[model samples]
Target: MPEFPHDDTTTNPFAAEPQDRLDANPRRAIVTGADSGIGRATAVALAAAGVDVALTWHSDETGAQETADEVRTHGARAVVARLDVTDIPACGDVVDGLIDELGGLDVFVNNAGAGLQTPFLDVALDEWNRVLDTDLTGPFVCLQRAARAMVAAGRGGRLIAVTSVHEHQPMVGASAYDAAKHGLGGLMKNLALELGHHGISAVSVAPGEIATPMTGQTDTDPRTEDRPGIPLGRPGDAREVAALIAFLASPEAAYISGASVVIDGGMLQMGPQAGAAVDTHDWRTL
Candidate 1:
């Protein structure tokens, strides 16, 4: 395989200006797609930060169990559930059942997603509907159910959507996926507005290429991969993304909401000029 180049730069993840704000107060959280990658990492992070987690998987109940085990290592009770977010009617039952089991819901991480990479012309109605329903509609329902529970709990909560960089930009062969992400981003913004008064914060975390099972990369060190397209010199790590979610879920982020944060290593900034910037053959052409 051809090697990808990574930007040879390093930066600190924390600031020295203000005292660090780390909270591990043992809250309850539900992380969808917790079977692997970003979902699994987020679950681990939440658990480590003193949050009991309900791990929901699309088709990886085994992986979800593994995550639950890791979560339990952090002394947080972890539960595993088979959750196909695309099954719209089943969403309510799943959410309600899980919340009931957990006693109460405090943070909901909508991390489940399905990607459809067909071009616009080749995308059939079923493909469009499948992607939209799974990526957009399913989360919409889950958000509502979680929000309702949060409102009733009267504790104010964190609602996070694990969107994509495509949520803010576009790709050649990802029309359907892009559409779904765009819709998800918009829905989060609206949810942020609607849920604010209830003390719930809705935010979208847009990740660029990350070393995750979703990207056909698991257990691979992203540091070894060369990704010139990313200013950071490599694709992101799932743990890195999870750290963001953990911070968002913490009490320190209580004042933040309705924000769409891009964690793409500056790829979004080079969108229009990437072709010219790469100095390679016309590989960008479809």
Candidate 2:
């Protein structure tokens, strides 16, 4: 088994102590960016919990199909679609497409995002736009579509988003990412307030460093040795984050809304991790 950051037996302070809150096990959800990384894990976890999943992919149809197959192996129907979150206008159509295919949408997880790590000084306008459009506006588009569907169905629904630890804290060289996530956090909160009367809830799950392809960094990398800063003394696993999303999407988490659950192993609370030491003897100016 591949060891993950949070694979240890030690307890996590951020997660709900008793996961019994989600015992009802609601089925049927749409997970955006479900082709790989944390999104794929969430889709699989939901399937394991008996949730039929509509898994969306952007540039990887094959990857999306693979996730769908996994979902089916878990005994839950899996619907796959190629969805580009940045295509703002088509977002509504995507939701309707999922609902039409899956029969109905009870839970919506906005997990599609693009990470931009350009320095603030060198960050271009287009980069900022791209990050904001995907991380913030994209979710809003899905939220609007999902909210309408939930209201029409006359049943309360769950609207969840996967933000980043930067949603609340700041990180150097991540200006675009930080701003977008921060905006997304605020967006979810506002949606929660507006939709609460209609029995709909919106929330965000912010993850820290996870052993995902996006980071391009591994546990063994000496640069990651400062994991001690995180109370858990390591990064988190994709599955661990998925578990939380599954719980929130279920009927049991109905009372939780407008909340941003930080799953960074207490890293955010402890402040930024120390910058890795680097050797700089030979240098060239570009």
Candidate 3:
């Protein structure tokens, strides 16, 4: 038998102290795409949790200001900024600026994403790249910046990505969207693994058919709507999704990293059953 080398310096991984420990209560957060929809809801939710928020928007400055107002109602500091994630590396700079304005960052929520409904065969190179840049590349840059800030501060943090149900299941006419979400979900898992040593948690919140502007259901009451395919009989509300995000951002979720939490109304569970029960081929088109 070969003699094993003595390794007196080896220590139990579980016994090692994290490079940075999470704050007992997170104090500041950033929510991108807070102009409206899920991002807006998440911003307000964090504020209600007594966390100061920095809100970023792409097109709707008015909407972002509205979200900031709501955040202020919770007695939390709210700062607004314009951020177009598709702008590439510049977006990462915007994140850094916001982190600075907030004094520090305890959480960063990547909620800005776009999808194209064009068929895969008809998708132009520009369109595909646009979607990918917005949904994946840009987010990766910003999240990386946020992670660096957290590491430098030596105070653990949370990184939340608002992915889609498409992250787990592909959709018709959503090739680029599906690919980006899948990549984002994978990225979050990797971040969780790499950042855990620093006490930072990374998670993905996947929503399905939410009543948001992205779904053309802004201001719509999901409870009043009916969805025959979903077991819950309706689409989800942004607030519901936000609530889940808020929980994940909390210290209570320190051990729940490297996970994609789905907030669909039992939609994923109906996959095979719905496929078998469909009475028409209309689903083939967007």
Instruction: Tell me which of candidates 1 and 3 scores higher on TM-score.
Output: 3
Q: Give the residue spans of candidate 3 off by over 4 A.
A: 1-20
**Relative to the unseen true structure, what is the C-alpha lDDT of residue 42 in candidate 2, on a scale of 0 to 100?**
96
Alpha-carbon TM-score of each model against the true structure:
0.89, 0.83, 0.94
lDDT of 3 by residue, 1-286 (tens): 9997654335645322432255468999999999999999999999999999999999999999999999999999999999999998999999999999999999999999999999989999999999999999999999999999999987889999999999999999999999999999999999998998777899999999999999999799999998999999999999999999999988778788999999999999999999999999999998
Q: Highest TM-score among the candidates is held by which one?
A: 3
Steric collisions counted per model = 3, 0, 0
Sort every candidate by TM-score, greatest first.
Answer: 3, 1, 2
Model 2 worst lDDT run, 10 consecutive residues: 277-286
TM match of model 3 to true structure: 0.94
The alpha-carbon lDDT assigned to residue 223 of candidate 3 equals 98
Clashes of 3: 0
- TM-score of predicted model 2? 0.83
lDDT, candidate 1, at 137: 91
